[model samples]
Target: MAIRLDFQTEKKQGSLLITEESESNKTDVIRGFFSLFGFEKEPMQTTVYSPEIVVHSQGKAEEIQKQVSEAINQRLQQLESRPSKDEVEIKKPELINSKRTLNPTIGEMIGGAPQQEAPPEEPEWYQTGIKNKEGVPHYKLRYWCKNPQCRDRSNDYIKEDQKTVKCRKCGQKLLVRQAADEHMKRDEWGNFFIADKLAP
Candidate 1:
């Protein structure tokens, strides 16, 4: 392929200076001028330049340079022109919409909290209390050792019974204890009778 030749002249210090050369014979001219211009500080940084091309049979090299000279001059205009930074305005960040409330219900306040059930109450008929006669402070169940903790069927024995109540058949001396619930009922020959232990 044939090489295209071009020349770049920078407009600085009121006069135009050659910064590029497409002709091989013009190296010394470009280097000396570039050395004075401080090539390191200049905006022109291209090390590789377009080679000066020679046409076969007709036309001068100076005339050949005209076509490519426009391209080099255009590049110099671009570098010399004041390059300004483009201002890109960033969109302000928006606050996310979170759920907030003024007054919340009990369900909302404890929505994620663990639930606890109340302890069960002891039944009146199933609970019986026997006191200590020896001046002990704490009260405990009297006939709790028997199969039926209450004195309804088996022996009536409080923990601190002073005297033993004798059994008629077995002669087993037993302790006398109070009935639970206090509404005691006795049965005699198919007849039912209510005892007054429940009276206030």
Candidate 2:
């Protein structure tokens, strides 16, 4: 007669080992044997069910057992040497800013220095008193560029039809001063204020 033997293996200390094996005379043995023994084993690894191995004598059974054991042990050793999912370490890629530079070249260092701009000049307004044809009092506001570096610094008058005015030569914005009356006196800063009345 012939016999079949089924075995299950387990992993321990990062290695696979056959901890349990059972024999069946003719039929397949259910893997529930390990559960009855109070613990569950790993999945079934190797099964030895060769029809050539006959048990006519006890010596033949011993030989069959030796051959099956060697086959199962060799397969287990192969599985053990391989790395498991938990044993592998997954490395993530590092992030970096595209515009940032670690080192500056000679050309970049020379051009990178920030240039300072010249401070703006204060505006000056010139007012001229005049009267309308109906004798209703009015005044004309005038201004010109005073920037020493501009060609328009000596330009006495700039005529414009629009209310908002800028220097024609230098393009700098000009301020305007309006007097409430001809008697309104102007300070050095172009601001108008009523002066105290003087005795005749």
Predicted structure with the largest lDDT when compared to the true one: 2
Models 1 onward score TM values of 0.18, 0.21
Q: How close is candidate 1 to the true structure, as a TM-score?
A: 0.18
- Clashing residue pairs in candidate 1, if any? 22-52
Against the true structure, whose TM-score is highest?
Answer: 2
Q: What tens-digit string does per-residue lDDT give for candidate 2 at 79-197?
A: 79989999989997767644566788576688974667887664333334332435544333345455556636322222223233455676665554332445344445443321121
- RMSD over all Cα atoms, model 1: 20.5
Per-residue C-alpha lDDT of model 1 across residues 51-148, encoded as one tens digit per residue:
33222322333333343455556666775685555554558775674556576657768784556878888744234433335665222322212213
Return the clash pairs for model 2, or none.
none
**Cα TM-score of candidate 2:** 0.21
Alpha-carbon shift of residue 2 in model 1 (angstroms): 21
